[model samples]
Target: MVDDVADSVGSVRPNCSRSWSNSGSFDLRFASDANGKYPSKIDFHQIGAGFGGHFWFAHTRKPGAMGGKMKVTGTWTLDHERTGPMKIMAALPDHGAHTEIANYRVNATRGPGGRVTKQPGDGVRWVSIGTYMFDGVVPKVTLSSETPYGTGENDIAFDAMAFIPIDGQYHEHTVEADALFDENQNIDTAAPESWLNESPLESRERLYNWAMTMSDKILSMKNCDSEVGDCLTPHVGAAVANWRSEVMAAGKDPINHPDGNSISSWIGFANSYKDRPDSYTRPDSFDDDSRFKIRTKATTTFVSDENGKIVPGSQSASYANRTADTHLPHFVLELFRAISEDYKISLPDLGYRAKDLNEHNGEYTSVDPLRSGIIPGRAYSYGGQAPKLTTYTGSGEQRGATCVAVRTVAGGSIGYRTLLSKEGPTTAMSDFSDTLSNSQYVAQSVWELVENIREMFFDSGSFPVVESSLYNVAPPIWQDLNFRACTNETVRKVDGYPILRASWMPDHYLYHNGTAMDQSGALRKTSLPLMRGDFENFSTATIEVAHEYTPYGQCRAYVEDNSFARNKNPWGINPVPRPGFNPSSVQFCSDPDLAPDPEYSSYDVS
Candidate 1:
């Protein structure tokens, strides 16, 4: 926050050194001041320069007329003198028509002296009109007629006005005589220009121009008069002194200075010459012109059955460890890791952490994502059992961090926090209290803007591809072992299309065309035949590699691979329960004749 020193009433510099006095008679406005009746003889003050067109009027007394009634309002800088009161004096032709004080308003200043019922002779006599107490060096005032003039003789003719210290009162000022302010304080004295709203080059150029103008105005020795010798020089220097004492010396930032400067330039004005840096990061080095793509990561998609079942034997072909494009899926985890590395902090990894029967008296809170469990990476499985899976639950239930709302903030950025709901048989949900920190809350506030983007991601119904080096495929290593089927290539070929092993490749995707095909050991490369058949039974069909490679060397997908048996537990026994199964440890039941025997088979740790 910038200090508001210049704006305070106590800091005003009085217009005391010289009397800001105006005089003369007859009907005249500042316009007529140079021509008609009272030609304003005083033109040296800023009152004339700052208000060139505005005027103070003087006229003969007349009732309800725009005469003898003048009101002028403007800023007045006073010397910072607390000891004495300044006197305000006004005059009129001694052949006076009664003119009572109309309205006198001076903020926190004192008094309009007793109105003069009589002045000595007809040659205009100046009486002690009003006494003004100084709140600061400068004070602002407005004066007008109390009662309208009546249709009488030419009685009240405003003659003159003056503001001066009540004789012999030593008035003081806040700024010193020799203080110097450079151009640095002029341009950089306000809020920073946002890079999102303006380009770096444009912001820099504007600042540069402002600095150059200030430099010329402040440093140049021209524009000086005999009385005020370079008036701006002292005031400008004073502004710099004020900035250093009030802001810089106190260790506050002079860039975006707090209190406004009286002069346009200051001590640190050179800082304005610095440039603003670019903020957006792009993946041009990765050869991926796609938006928000990370060259270091790729998305590996694992397809599961419609019932959300994880078949143990198919784990290897189904699980690929590549990064995703657009980055929403792994954005949080990646951000956390990056922050951890940069700050040298040991943040927890993104994985499950079952309640330890030892710590916290083994009485952990139920369904707490922060302590009890965490969803595995790439937790979002589209068109599967769980659409939103950022949150993890202690028990096997659909109770993870499900984002129901998002918010946007400055720079059009977004952040997301978890939302809890009670639906179906699950009565409990995870509230995001433990999910975000104070700083994270700021990020999540901005994240609210992602709701629209979230809708787009779901609507596309397609997975993003990233660089292949991101993930390592699981075992069952189908690509390593050739077909062990005791059969030749002739039998493996169906309708003249060769059968190939389904291996997880980098930057490759498996596409499913919403068609119904037989859940058999093998599938066809073409969807023309399958589209004609009834697909209702396969609402959530399986997808596999189509033609080993597309014409452009990209891999094509073939859905409904039924050649392999439905995956069973690696051993002949079901070792674990639903939702908590770790697909990484899955092993294939290689023996075709082997049947599950609950009593005979034992659970083995892979």
Candidate 2:
């Protein structure tokens, strides 16, 4: 079976979920200064201190830039001088898009001689805990010791890496459904014709410049006003070095190249050199007439120019792991931007500013956690009530609960009116419904259609009895339906006939009946309100009750023989007439006597 498929059309695989799985295993070692404890506070220079007793964000080796599932295996060993007992703990974020592969724990058991080891092993007792997937999120690890540093007892040595499984990484983009509705194939004219939003490269230069500025900013942060290497320094240094190396191999002189000694100076400064002079550039020839070139880690064989077109024969200036090289700078910029405020980094030029990074302490910062993850906030809810409404409309001055008229097709005259309000306390009241907010009206309507369809095909019992196995098979478009928990329990067609019984909220029922509000089953409670469409309704239609059949999966022909004695107006605009109907009259046609007059002939087949 095709698990998922995306097309140019708006219809998409509604319920399919994407995630990362563990690829392989690696290790983590933590030093005292990196622990953020006393004797070494995480100040400007101590970037590692920020991750002390907490998590630090970094990249992995196996997956490279295009991320995936990562299996993290490592040993957590304590490096304390006088260790009586200590706690060694490590963790990966279980929030945001990053899901924990499994629940695990590591206990640091002190072996003889103040030596800590894992259970059931020798030489530091290595324990393998996770088969994790970071997806697009930057991987982070957290560490803590029973006795923290500067206490003369707590010190930790952590060394770990993630092995990204190459396969479980790619995710298909979700389609933006704007023009069409999922049910009745309705189209909304106000919606844009095209779902795709084609954007120009408006922020290309700004983003590039931001990356450069971030590179500079990270280097400028000083502890005690002295420059020092932190976790990110090496990456920038390596990138610059690689870029400069490519320039030189292209036979470009360091003094004359546009990037010039700038990249070189950055590299040298990161490496603790006061300044790098031109003598550092080797005069050796990089050219070889032979087809084979010197082996390097570069992934690309040709360099691209400003327009992104390949520069002819510019092999020497080509980049390796081009995808990683392309995105690493952006990652640095975004990561810093997430926590920049706490560190006193200036905004205005960073494109966006974030509130609190620690709010997502154990979550994936897949660029920005807030953009992908939802944070639930509580709203004060007080009870109120509204009296029964008296309505004067096409439906005979209906005086009852609230109902809404929805136009299925844009600009068409007919509207489908469905009863929505529930019968409850007399006092005025308002609350959030299962349909969610105003923006979700379309999704809620679509969900209602699917819910009714399921009821018609399976619970109504009006059609031929489908095999029980068929009932288990999910409908193509029904996956998006949010059905009620009590639906299966309450819907039982013992008579083997249409559940015209005053309540079955079936699709066909919507065609000829109006429903009342009732709640029979109440299960779990949540912050979000229950969907009103989920409950069974109250309608005063004639019910042809049938006896409970003896065996299940009895396939029989649908209603095939009726005297055509009566017919009802399919539209609920007028009250349907009731006739002396035969309970055994198994026919698809409605009673002819109740059919609508010529003026109100048009009806929707629900």
Candidate 3:
């Protein structure tokens, strides 16, 4: 923001020592007549440099032709002023600078609004003129314009008093008076070379050039600009050559030598001169060439039989029989431990173990040199069960041991899989039926719990009090966990992925339970211990419901089905029982026929 220090009228306090005046013409005066004699006032003039300031004009008289009238418009600037002895014949310097002014003319006609609208005549015509004036010190300058007959003639004058501040203020000065003219004329011509020819070029150049030269000289005054600390002349080409030679001589092998490789040589040269000329040299050391060598040592270990000979396993002859002894058992145990830790479940281990083999042979007749018999019953048969043992082998025979092993216990273990539906009932179908039944039981238990909570809140004046009384006087422990799980599920679905776990559920549940219990107790003026007990029960029930309902696939399916049911019958009149059975309902049955009436069914007696 530029400051608006000058008033709207453009006035400034004048210095008492300065004398100024303005003639009605385009002339101005500034003088200090030390003689104190009239007409002896030293003068400063305004030379017509060009038109700039505001100006106006009026016609002298109306034209005979209605629209054939000439009007003038102009602007001007003072160029230069002259000052010399007033009437001295001593050939005093011309002592005056040039000034100029400009104006324009156009034909116009009067319009209904008293407007002087320009006619379809010549465009604004410009006229420029210059003048020179002198007094003993500075001269007066003025500008005037004359229009054609019947057109107005106007004159503009600049007040020397107003300009006194500008003259008295600080301004750039030039030694050669001619320099002022060159500036006014907008000339780029350099100062006369004659002055340079008479003096040293070093002293004649501009300050900037002098500073640059000094910087360059200081930079080049030092030595040891090479990597080997070798002294070289202050030139880039020579320094690079010297540094390269030093690096090549440091090694006997051509490929290994720093200068023998283009990249290394370039890097070495750059490092050598990085800060050499301007300051102390600091070069980087080269990398050791041995880093490029490849290792030939083997990283893999192999297992062998008792006879120190390879055994035949599933697909090929084995060099090391990991399954024959310790390897397979160790690896299997490790895998079991890892799975148990991951699933947070424990499993009992089988006593028998086998070794990891580098190769396998499917032929049963192959002898096991280490063991007495042929692989010691490589195929296990229990209760006449067809080979209950699992063979761990890879496709390629000679590629080494199988990275992993498969364990086949006598009876199948608990595992997760998608159950396939069968048209006809079978043993597998029965097992799936059992699983489905269990899932329904769990789902129904959770849904009933939620409905009970909702109903309690609706029926009781105090929602928390009812919730506490129904769910063991514990705080509303499950609200935070359920809300967070719901929110997380939404976020995961929106991000195009499935929600794996509700990591924040436990903490969220605790926080909300505490808050609810505290607020309820405060409102009811109940004992803290009673409130806490109530809260604890409510929280426990809520958490039980949330935990059983909010697993990955379970939560996603529940939300989808609930959302669908809500959207289909937004009025909440849907009387259809949920997919899973509700243990809390009086009619707790698995039959769909005995379920609650459909909320949207038209089979009504009305």
TM-score of 2: 0.14
Better of 1 and 2 by lDDT: 1
Model 1: which ten-residue window has the lowest total lDDT? 406-415
Q: Name the regions of candidate 1 deviating beyond 4 angstroms.
A: 1-334, 337-444, 447-577, 582-606
Lowest-lDDT window of 10 residues in candidate 3?
174-183
Q: For candidate 1, what is the lDDT?
A: 0.23
Q: What does each candidate score in C-alpha RMSD?
A: 39.9, 33.0, 49.0
For residues 1-606, could you state the per-residue lDDT of candidate 2 as single tens digits?
000111121222344233322222233332223334322222101112111111222222122111211212233222222212111123222111111111223231211111121111112222223223232332333332221001112122332322222221111101000010111111111112111111110122322343344445443433222332232333334443344343243231223333423322221111111111113121122111011011011011122233332222221111100000001122223332332332333321211221111111111221221232211110000000111111222121222311111111000000000000111200011111122213221223222322332222112122211311111211100000000111011211111222121101111101100111112122222211112111111111222222121111111222433211111111221112111010111111122122222111111111
Cα lDDT for residue 335, candidate 3? 27
lDDT of 1 by residue, 482-601 (tens): 110100101111222222222221111111111111212133343222111111111111222422211111112222443332221121212111222222222212222323221111
Q: Is candidate 2 or candidate 3 better by TM-score?
A: 2
Segments in model 2 whose C-alpha atoms lie over 4 Å from true places = 1-74, 77-352, 355-606
- Residue-level lDDT tens digits of model 3 in 128-230: 1111113322322222222122222222222121111011111110000000000011111122311222211112122223223332432343443332221
> Which is better, 1 or 3, measured by lDDT?
1
By TM-score, the better pick of 1 and 3 is 1
Which segments of candidate 3 are over 4 A away from where they belong? 1-241, 244-261, 265-289, 293-297, 301-606
Q: State each model's CA lDDT, in order.
A: 0.23, 0.19, 0.18
Supply the global lDDT for candidate 2. 0.19
